[model samples]
Target chain A: MKTRLMVLAISLASFSGVAMGFDFGKLLEDRLNQELNKDKKTQPATTPPPAGSQSAAASPPATKQKVDAGQLGFALFGDYSPEEENRIGKQISGNLLGAVPLVRDDGLQRYVNLVGNWVALQAGRKNTTWHFGVLDTEDINAFAAPGGYIFLTKGLYRRLNNEAELAGVLGHEIAHVTQRHHLKVLKKSSLIGALGQAASSKAQGSDQMVQNLIGNGAEIMARGLDKDAEFEADRVGIVFAARAGYDVWGLPTVLQDMAALPAKDNRTSLLYKTHPHPADRLAALGEAVDGRLDGIQGKELANRFYKIR
Target chain B: MKKFLIPVSAFLLCVSAASAWASPGTVLRNEQLFSQPTSGSRVEANVAKGASVNILSKQGGWLRVTAGRSTGWIRLLSVRAGAGGSGGSGVGDVFGAATTRSDPSRVVAVAGLRGLNDEDLKQAKFNAGELARLEAGTVTTSQAQSFAKQSGLASVNVPGLPEPRPAQPSSSWENN
Candidate 1:
């Protein structure tokens, strides 16, 4: 009976990985096997299973199940393939640029990308082809698109006191990508399903679905991620910055600065609508950083930051 | 002898209490510790990289830290806060657990038209050229490393922070 339960647990564990939206079945399988092996090693000798059960455990039933190619593709590639996500991101990015001009300074753009890329390398999805841009708008805003695109408005850029602050902002956006926040939102919005149906049917209306998906994704982006997601991004962002050797206070300090800005400021209107008030963000961040990060002093690099700008 | 021991223990208690100011910080770069938190004050000592100091307090950008027996001020930028700060497993689980909640079936079929208002997001048009430009600006890892080296930013291994507790209902933004 214990062996049966163990087999069941292993089968469910493997299936759960696929069901949880992980696209890499092989990776998941390997991880599950490792976990199982680790558990076996750590099990107490007094509760050791019968010798016959050892062989049965060694070859779990989960690995023997035949995974269909279609099922495998769906399970291994998530709802959208990486290429599909990249294409969608490009289209949305194009549309976004159409609405707001990018700051055309090549040097400044490169500098931002360099800093952003450095911070992004420390993220979980390090291999993602990250791109960073400065939007030409004066609105105090930043954005992240699926497939590793991050943007910071010039207004927000100019206000940052140091590289750590800039890193904090970029890290927040990168956190969005690593967490797939927008992508999950897109998947949940019905637009992807409509596109999938149109594509499968070879209908002429597929183009319309594409446009709708893009539009809806843009609207979601503009409207902003859920408050929970925003808070999660803040925590992840600070971690990334701290991992990359920037002051963890950068995010909290920026929050404080934003909080200090008058509520009526036009520049903050869009940002305010899309995010929790800065005071709330600050309080959340303060709690995270106060005791945890108070020991390690990180570099602000203010002079170098100003020089690049 | 009992009275003497009691006085010694009381003095030690006071010392321990005084030493526990705040979190400890590590020096990121070689910097001067000043007698006063301000730059104009006399130099107390020259602290090198990787020195551990207990942060006593902060005066603007200067941190009051005690490195060894010397208690002085160091520029906030000169030290990295926390010891061996690494983005711990605490955060990984919080982010990993975020599942999509929106139901696709509830989405409105009618697509809206676009304009400048925030509501115009429904009608946004794609600009391929701008995307191409954005993609073109990506920097390679080596380039990023060089950039970091140029800015004197060195990677430090700080332990990841624990998962933040859920926000309290008393937050001021709840009204918004």
Candidate 2:
């Protein structure tokens, strides 16, 4: 009996180490108990929930991971000279626009685009032109493709409260484009070579989409970006958003929402996969906005361009 | 009257020749050039190579050159003469010191294995030697990770950390 208990302890300890940021130990124990109860001898109907399981309500899994869309975008922007970054942006813009049927809620797209333009102008990328688009999908995702192309998912759009939030998100995305962080990451991963290889292929349509999704996602999350990159993006994003007349609090608030999300809180999912923790990001954003914009409050210019219920 | 005019013309020619001779070698040097004279400032504007400068005087290892529109002095050693016989002095400018920082590119082949975060697991390539090289200071940390990812080991566990047993073992391994 003592040896069995020891085995359980070691298993739990090992499970905890492997499951960092996840509550898999209790789940594992419950499964073990279930197996034991199925024996020919006397079997307990149900096992007690593990001790840590009680706090499950407080912290659900990783559905709420903070995704550094900026890093994702920057990973696409290689460390080309400012001139090269601009040229690549133009090429990517032409290629992606030709490929994807971008979301065109005229009002929303224009509003987001205007905000994006304003933020981009303030962020000051002298060489590249910035373009923003809305995707028709309901998934809660926003992507900044290489070469200054940004796509906002309808799911993310429907969840936003106002222009400030949109501007805040746009600012983050713009920062990614300006910083060319995606390309820096790609260079880190050596995917820039793969891009040259990809270029040689004649693949188009769904094939390109598959290549893009797989290539792009692998490029960004592969080997996991350093935590510093996400932190810097948030810092720069807040400033750009604030300069573009969006309330500085929008970023923090968005982060709060993300932290409160249920289902995606795995450590790897939260940090290496998506980005830094939303809580950490929120805290960083708060510190950045504080005292920086003294007496500067932004007003939202709402119109037919966008409406929030 | 002819003799008088001839003497006067000769005198004028002599004066002109002397002035021309004086201008060519009038190079300034060091403290003598910077000493309180024409312009009243401790420092002069940045001087470029092959710039034209008028030498006011040549002192011990220094030259008082007319820098830009204003005249100031610079070390004669610091100034180089223009390509021609023109008595021009060189100007020296100050720049901030450059510092050496680590490069991420060098560590592309030997990165150490750490457990993968979900993001890292997605990668299909990685190079361990590059990561090890980085840890060994042979490459940069960023480069090491990059190589590890490229070599398809992005999600492999970091070597330094305690590892769990593999889910399955071969019969020879199990015997041990």
Candidate 3:
């Protein structure tokens, strides 16, 4: 089981090099055979340890090998193209919307897009178009998908006192996309995650191939990326907000508010599940920031902050 | 060990116990507190790591704090506002989410609202209309630029932060 996982990790890590010169197919074939030989004696394949993850390594190789012999290696090891990333993001976002639709207020949605786009403009990913949504749910959390889909719950939005804080929050989510954090998590499961687009509505815009890559529903969002990924987003996020000329303290202040909330707040249930404690995040951010941001004189624009009814 | 971060603004009060003159904080590192918020100012006191200080006020990236009898300004990041201190150890975490990871069945619904769960996301089906609405709301870069300009939110040239050094639990605040 360990050897099988190591093969997957190594291939995933070295994927970028395949286009440069490495014979990825041969490497994946060799590694697959080795993994198969090692796991040959082991009973059915072990599931991915991180519960709720839908990944190829978790599937028994015996069944996968027999069902589709040729495509297995590339399907499991190849990196996603930009187009593929967008489609995957769209499917995930569509499903997420089905679960909880976007906030009905057009003004709020437009305002978020404006703020999100402003923050993302500094993110350095010019080729990708971004989509920002304010989900109506009272859940106090934000989410990012592979492409450029970013969502923050209305509950979280209500907590902000200014556009800078909103920018800070948006900055964190934008960082997730710029850093390709969701894609990193999706890459693992992309192999087995494709439970087919069977459950999806045969709607006008849905892509079957992307559906197969994401697994059932939008479970990937629920599964979440690891803690390290979340911390990385926080680090990248504050910078994005600051680079856009907003107060860098926006994100940290939001963390302080979260830290002060009662332990039983249901709004934060999903957030704490996928992220480190707010206090821990603050400490981590403190390490990366310390004196580095002192020179910046950014805006906290408390007056321009839009109030929600 | 109660924290008191009384911000000048009423909305800035994060905790109900914040009725005092100043907020409490934990010093992340053993650093000098300057007489002014700037590092070029005269050093007033050298505070040790893990020491408690009262955060009197804040400037851009500095906080005016009083440590013991000595009072001076330190880098804002140098102090975390709370009695829980670094990592909020033993402090009320304000969320029961992490525990649910170990046992999804252990979810406690204290907030009355039926919060989002893994099952809902897992069982969700696509809604193309909503996705269309989301995309329709996308603002063009130029549009976003104008919107920012309206609020005087111009783009700036801030350097990216360096990843924390020492890969294993890098923050010094956590060491203590």
Candidate 4:
């Protein structure tokens, strides 16, 4: 009777162990599925949303997540976070302010912000804190830093014919921010790699390395992005402007105006150096605007622009 | 001087006329042409996919096009920018023609500018105070919306167009 009782007890213990093992396996599988679903939801942050579903409220949380993860990793490496881009943008923007003076016109600043923010809201990543500033310089130029900071020179501002024209230029700069053009250039230049190293290493030299990266980034911004990026900005800029109810021709008109200027003018010198030739830009924009945008009748708002100016 | 002025005026007229002429484009998708640029306007016609139209004018996000004598507005995103049924040569031809005008002297002059150059960037000091001030100037999204409403800028639902591929090799500015 004692031997039979012992055998029953051993069998019961083995049965309980197998049941526990099966439960553990199920738990692992469930957890993995949950993680995979979470990843799938978050991965489309960079891709554009489908048409007719572009409402700002309808945008996925992945965009917000991507922006918040700026400190994490290369966005291309599945870790490039917008928060990281914002941090880098802030640092570079600070350096830029040191290089140029800001235009302190309250009304003008507000006008630019209204226009810029309106257009930026139309973008896929609409949550960025888009800031627009007018630099108090006569250089006919505009610059975009990552993280939605855009600057336009007073010269460029004064040259614009109307609000639609202004929107076109701002839209172009905004495209750079939306597309993260400067950030891509920085990434390709080993600046981001150095930054990664700086973040990982606790050495004293890491600070210097980071500073160097910023320096290089500032240099690239001043030098201008690669031509592909500039053209893309022009293309995307018009779309954004058009999307925001501005005349789509605003960018092309501005490009034509720029092209008509002599190549040797100092006002255009910096702009010319940093951008594709106005003619090339014009032709490219011409192609973009010719048929696709021709039928779109957007608000020119010339009188309102004049009032603001 | 009079002779020169005449030739210049004629050349300018030619340029203007060339620019003013609208290029023909084909519809990439079945879309409705509205009487006005807005979507709420009366639908003038249903433009089928692959339809040909002479793109005449633009009103915000809509295009005024002529498709088979029925002139009306179509969404700008519904049409590709060239005449060919397939992707056309507009971008390629324009870029090819533009590459020949590169002037080396103008490039050198641009390199000599003072602020925001490579050396200036290298020597740039970070100004956190200025950055903070700039950030403070930002308008909230609500403020922007109110401003848009005040400005009569209605939020139109223009379909997002596909990103155009880089039509040219990186221009001369890349080497700088």
Candidate 5:
């Protein structure tokens, strides 16, 4: 009797964290007792109710564990809907913001959004709603979520000599979103587990819909994409910036600045870990762009660049 | 004359501010050094793929460099501005300090700041309130277009570069 009471107490404690109704807690205790009774083997396995009205009142989803390719929009081939992609991005971006909030500068945030959205316009992904923010951290890096969510650290922002450079950085991240690089990576790494978790998670009342799809926190951002994906982003990003009427050399210049940094700079630790060496990127970019960009005319806009206060 | 001086002075300020002056750089491939920043200018000298050049100044996509006795402008892409000779093939990294923090300004910028690593991200919580704030700052495409118009940044007709054919030499990055 004491053990059963302890089990009931544990069930109620766990369920209470999600702020479910007390009726649901009682239902869970009944389910717990049913499981304990089945464990003794003397009694036939008694199944818990599919869901008590109290639990059903919480509006849980269907209890299906099967996931087809279409649901994930498997990116290159699978057509994951924009709505699904936006949820993943929101969860990831929200987690990242939790780690490091926005820089608290309205002007900086406004400037970044304007510039990011302008460059994104050239990307031609009309279906995606782009949101850009500058992270408060001084760590020099940038990130892009699956659905048009992008960020650059304040440290990286400070390194920009002009708006062109900022456009270049934003363009690179924008390429990642347009390319669906993260979605592809997520799809490839943990398909079985993620799909199952995603299906199971839907039945819960919490807002972690596809939380299992990406695992904990914003760690996916730190899991760098493949070399070719990165290189492709660099190539595509340069064109994106150029097409937006900014100097073609903007991304290259940013890479040069990063390449020239001393190897020990902790600020670049995440960057180097998550990217090809700036030297390698510059070389690869050179191979693609030997004389192609020669005739292109664009703006540097050095004077109008917003200085971070 | 004063107008020309303005550009030259601004150019010099950029080079100094970059602090890449006299920085050791490795030429990624053989490139011709031009007397001016543009390709149409006179060719001063040709530097080989593995040659080391001293980065003197930068303007747009060009880097004025002194390779051996030849001092001229080279396409910035043709050279990487650091001491990693030929980059990853491991040629001139004898002291191993080639990539050491050499720029004073960069050193200052990097000082006293803790890096954001994988752990901090993995342990982060969801900030729904901040997410709302981020969404609030988004600009519509029309708003962006008008903003671009304010700066005279019209869209242009630039073709995307062709993806390079594979078969790059073994790179250290692949190991990662």
Candidate 6:
């Protein structure tokens, strides 16, 4: 029975990879077409619109419109190119991690890595190399950096009751990466160049001070966005999680719990400042999760991580 | 038949004395008690489960006792005289609506917040991310509840507690 269950789990994991929403193969093909178009524009209109670029006008009777990384270009730093977002996302992720002390427990690291690798296999973004790290701080926080880097705080470890919730967190961050929210923000704001310059300078600081700054930066990023952007991530996050076979209810339940925490007199703490008010997020999620994935739970994954402390 | 009857006849039907917490003396029987209040209207409901009542002041059998949350009244036998603490161990009870896996790759994602530590900051972060992903309409709330039943956390009384007084005529007890 155990072997059968393990086989089932393995099958589900692989199936999840194949089912990811964003088709990497198609996304890459679209990117190549965009490059050809640019070359044609440069060459007095003589360079053919590449082999696949012409038939892929996106307005075909049968073919779907092409969508490239740059087509998500509006999220670039005003730079209309695929390379720009990749470079920018990598740099931002690197600089951000350099400033924070990632959590460093062997057991947790292995666990996070194993789970993360499993999730990544499900994610199926071959172009993006996923790196998972745990931060040692007591702050209850985790965030996805561009370029597929996800970080978790030690404080997060102390209070978790099970693994499903962990999956929820990872899946949501995965959504952010897959949706190219970081790039979207860069494209929306002109921060990519400025951020790149900072990266080039090799900015250095103490963990405490750096954390404070990064925390503030996270708040700024969260606050400066369109509400729709966040909504998009939440929606996709559920898809990622549901497809992976974890209990989906944990998503909203946690939000409700957080929102229900007795409101503190002062909300100036860095954590609150950076994250969305749990209440608002909960309401948003409630609407988002209305009536989807009903009757999907099976006894297996629902009871999978019940041994949580 | 004689062999069967010999040892069987030696068995005695013994009755245990009730009111284990009374004053310095008597062994009381047929004891009954009501719950008391510790505080608020939302007092933990476990107190009324077989608790002893002092009848300090009662509109009825609803005497007050120190429920974890507050004081409240319970019928005389709502709580048994000898019963101590809530019926179950504080934690380890499972709670939440069950949901099936939507995608196998996204196990952690679909797992959503079920197993995340409530008090952890990482949980908060993951929660936010999950919130965003759920916007896509794939997540389900199916079920969510704490593992603890009568633990340090909040408690709700089983409704119509102690089973509504059994409907029977007073003469029946006298005949017994």
Q: Pick the candidate with the highest DockQ.
A: 3
Model 1 misplacement above 4 A: A1-79, A191-210, A306-309, B1-117, B166-176
Q: What order do candidates take by TM-score, descending?
A: 5, 3, 4, 1, 6, 2
Docking class of 1: incorrect
What is the TM-score of each predicted model, taking all chains together? Answer: 0.58, 0.41, 0.75, 0.59, 0.76, 0.43
Candidate 3 lDDT for residue A100: 95
Q: How large a fraction of the reference contact set does each model reproduce?
A: 0.40, 0.02, 0.68, 0.36, 0.73, 0.00
- Number of the top candidate by lDDT? 5
- Model 4 DockQ reads 0.19
lDDT of 6 by residue, B139-159 (tens): 111111122111211121111
Of candidates 6 and 3, the better by DockQ: 3
lDDT of 5 by residue, A1-309 (tens): 434433433333334234352544545435444543443333223322222212312211211111122222132123456766787798889889879999999999999999999999999997899999999988999999978899999999999999999999999999999998887676544332233222222211223535555866788888889778898999999899999999989999999887777766788878887888788889899999998899888898988899999
Cα lDDT of model 3 by residue, A75-193, tens digit: 45345556656867899999999899998998899888988999999998868999999998888989999788999999899999888889989999889888887776665555453
Candidate 3 chain A, which ten residues in sequence have the lowest lDDT sum? Answer: A46-55
Instruction: Provide the lDDT at A283 for model 2.
Output: 38
Cα TM-score of candidate 2: 0.41
Better of 4 and 6 by DockQ: 4
lDDT-sorted candidate list, best first: 5, 3, 4, 1, 2, 6
After superposing candidate 4, which stretches have Cα over 4 Å from the reference? Answer: A1-77, A191-210, A306-309, B1-116, B162-176
Model 4: per-residue lDDT, tens digit, A1-309? 323322332232223235543444334334333433444432323333222221222123333233222222132222235665666677677767767768877888888888889888877685589888888776788989888889988878877888888998998999898887776666444323322322222222122333434444256566677767787888888888888888776876676456544445556646766787655565455455445544567888888783434
Arranged by DockQ with the best first, the candidates are 3, 5, 4, 1, 6, 2
Provide DockQ values for all models, in the order shown. Answer: 0.17, 0.01, 0.38, 0.19, 0.38, 0.02
Residue A268, candidate 6: C-alpha displacement in angstroms: 8.8
Which pairs, if any, clash in model 3?
Answer: A194-A212, A263-B94, B4-B23, B5-B23
* DockQ, model 3, C-alpha based: 0.38
Query: What tens-digit string does per-residue lDDT give for candidate 3 at B32-122?
Result: 9897889889998899888988777777677787787677788766677755445653324443324432234334444467678888898
lDDT of 2: 0.43
As for candidate 5, its clashing pairs are A73-A79, A73-A80, A262-B101
